[model samples]
Target: MGVHLDLSLDADGHHTFQWRRSDEPGALQVAPDTLQRWTAEHEQFRAATARWQQVMAEVDEHLLGDRR
Candidate 1:
């Protein structure tokens, strides 16, 4: 995916999301099934990954009871 962003020379730096350029980038599209499968399986989805894991934990706990 081509975004309006860049970086280097600082490995310990943060990454940021940027808007797309005026011209459309073809790389933005992934297979629809792949995207859905990722959302269903992976706990990681960009920077919101932590939130997803937290919610999954809560759901599991609610179903199985708190293990703590």
Candidate 2:
């Protein structure tokens, strides 16, 4: 929750973007390259998340000596 940006599609089929900072009281002022940075960060995050999921799926639950 430190700092984050979001992008979505509105009902009118247009792109909506926003950024927030938990340390600040209001919306953040975006820089010119904000979208470019978000795109790169999001791609890296997605790749890392997918790799994590794949690793978890390959793990043997019995190794932890726990059952759910």
Candidate 3:
């Protein structure tokens, strides 16, 4: 009766998401809206991470200029 969602890497090493119910035999494709939401969330996460990395780089430059 319960459902499970999992994230895994495919053969090409890309991230994939799958969901299944206890009574189901195989993984089910994610719904279109759910997939779209996940993609949007992932993009937001990536953008946030990139901004963080840039901030860290600037800090490093300010602290360790011409040394690193």
Give the alpha-carbon lDDT of every model.
0.52, 0.66, 0.70
**In TM-score terms, which candidate is top?**
3
RMSD of 1: 9.2
lDDT of residue 16 for candidate 2 = 57
lDDT for each residue of candidate 2 in 5-67, tens digit (9 for 90 to 100): 577976757665656565565545556476568768867866996798788866865556566
Candidate 1 per-residue lDDT over residues 1-68, each given as its tens digit: 23243333334374433333333554454455655565455334454766876899999989787555
Ranking by TM-score: 3, 2, 1
Give the winner by TM-score: 2 or 3.
Answer: 3
* C-alpha lDDT (0 to 100) for residue 49 of candidate 2: 67
Deviation from native of the Cα of residue 46 in model 1, angstroms: 4.5
TM-score of each: 0.29, 0.44, 0.56
* Stretch of 10 with least lDDT, candidate 2: 23-32
**Which scores greater on lDDT, model 1 or model 2?**
2
Q: Residue 26 lDDT in model 2? A: 56
> Candidate 3 at 50: error in angstroms?
0.6
Clashes of each: 0, 0, 0
